[model samples]
Target: MRDADTPRQEPTDDRSHPAALTPQQRADLIRAAAAEVRERVQAWRDNPNWRNTPANSHRYETTLGAIGVLSELPEPQTEEALASLADAVRPIVVEWRPSRPGPEQSIYAAVERLWRTIDVHT
Candidate 1:
């Protein structure tokens, strides 16, 4: 029965989305997600053959989708923290060959955005 201009109400359940997160909780989520990105990038880099494979592409896509959400975390970033992440990803950039933007490029892109977001906010 409310008019369209009425401000929408947030869920009072305290379990809804970002509202459920305290600053510490949100920071922890960001840390965890960044860690996952670092780990996945290392996993791919360590096993170079997996970069452009057929069977693994699906899995990479799913992981990238998750990383995309992590990259979108709504928080101001600390550059020192983000710098290590960018450094973790630096080697990935070194290995990239320009053909098209596929799995490796997508992974690279997400981490690139992640660090850049963190840097910009800092």
Candidate 2:
């Protein structure tokens, strides 16, 4: 019988939960999410509507910098990696206002998906 002080355990067979994942598995998922962030950011930058002003350029650089940090993170740093990804995608998630549906929206959606993974699993 389980004691009152003992914690309940989640099923390991459910890969969707982070508690059920090995460190390597979590790192792999974080890497995939980071890759998606990179792809979406690149697409946004490539869009003709994107401006080349200094402020915009700075935002782009900062976001990419965060992604780079996440990419190089070693395994067993899942929380750190997620923090970096969140920082990387903040501009897209919070600031960018696309006039119409385009790469900006794609980038936003990608960021949201990454955060969702963190939320659901973590």
Candidate 3:
């Protein structure tokens, strides 16, 4: 028997989602990602065409998908999803290069830096 107003709860697998970590980890990820990207704003401004490159384009979209989930989901619980996202983005970031000026590389570099924190802490 259940109350009509009770929210439906899905059974969560134990291992697929690790035990929730401290919320500080979540805050740190968001902070680091923001700082990394913001610091490279000038580079992005200088080489606006980097977005057109295939590697950068793919990297950018993958990063956004990770961030989308991170931003939308609750913290601690978001850790597993974040780790999966980081793992997926790693290869792309590793292979990415600047198609424009060297400064343009900072965009993906920033992304890599952000992803590292997620990798290291998790």
Candidate 4:
């Protein structure tokens, strides 16, 4: 069952849609998202308790690896150039959730905002 208030999920077919962006636009969106993620991860690492929890530490490392891959691109990519990247990376964004409610709200909120922006921009 579905509710009228629920937002419709965007179709996954990158090639068939009229709203589809050009290769350059997709690349720009990817770069922007990657930059935002990197900045957030850096702030997380700066927290004194970030390394105290093994799970948190592992998450930080995984985020670092993802950022590294994004940063290593020889040049900015095009929309077609980024389709594979988007497919490979979307799952990671989908899997993220805020672990707690207070300060964690910012991270989760940012994730949601970023997700929406990427969805539309890409």
lDDT (tens digit, per residue) of candidate 3 on 1-122: 66999775634434322224454554555455645654464455446464566755665555455455545544334556555545544544554454454655566666565554555644
What lDDT tens digits, residue by residue, belong to model 2 across residues 45-102? 8878888889668757766776677666555555555455445444444544443477
Please write out the lDDT profile of model 4 over residues 68-101, one tens digit for every residue: 6656654436555565555444544664587775
Residue 65 accuracy (lDDT) in model 1? 48
Count of residue pairs whose backbone atoms collide, per candidate: 0, 0, 0, 2
lDDT of 4: 0.59
What are the lDDT scores of the predictions, listed in order?
0.48, 0.62, 0.52, 0.59
Which 10-residue window of candidate 1 scores lowest in summed lDDT? 10-19
Candidates in order, TM-scores: namely 0.33, 0.63, 0.46, 0.62
Ranking by TM-score: 2, 4, 3, 1
Give the higher-lDDT candidate: 1 or 4: 4
Candidate 2 clash pair list:
none
Clashes of 2: 0
Candidate 1 lDDT score relative to the true structure: 0.48
Candidate 3: lDDT over CA atoms? 0.52
Candidate achieving higher lDDT, 3 or 4: 4
Rank by lDDT (best first) = 2, 4, 3, 1
Error of 3 at 55 (Å): 3.5
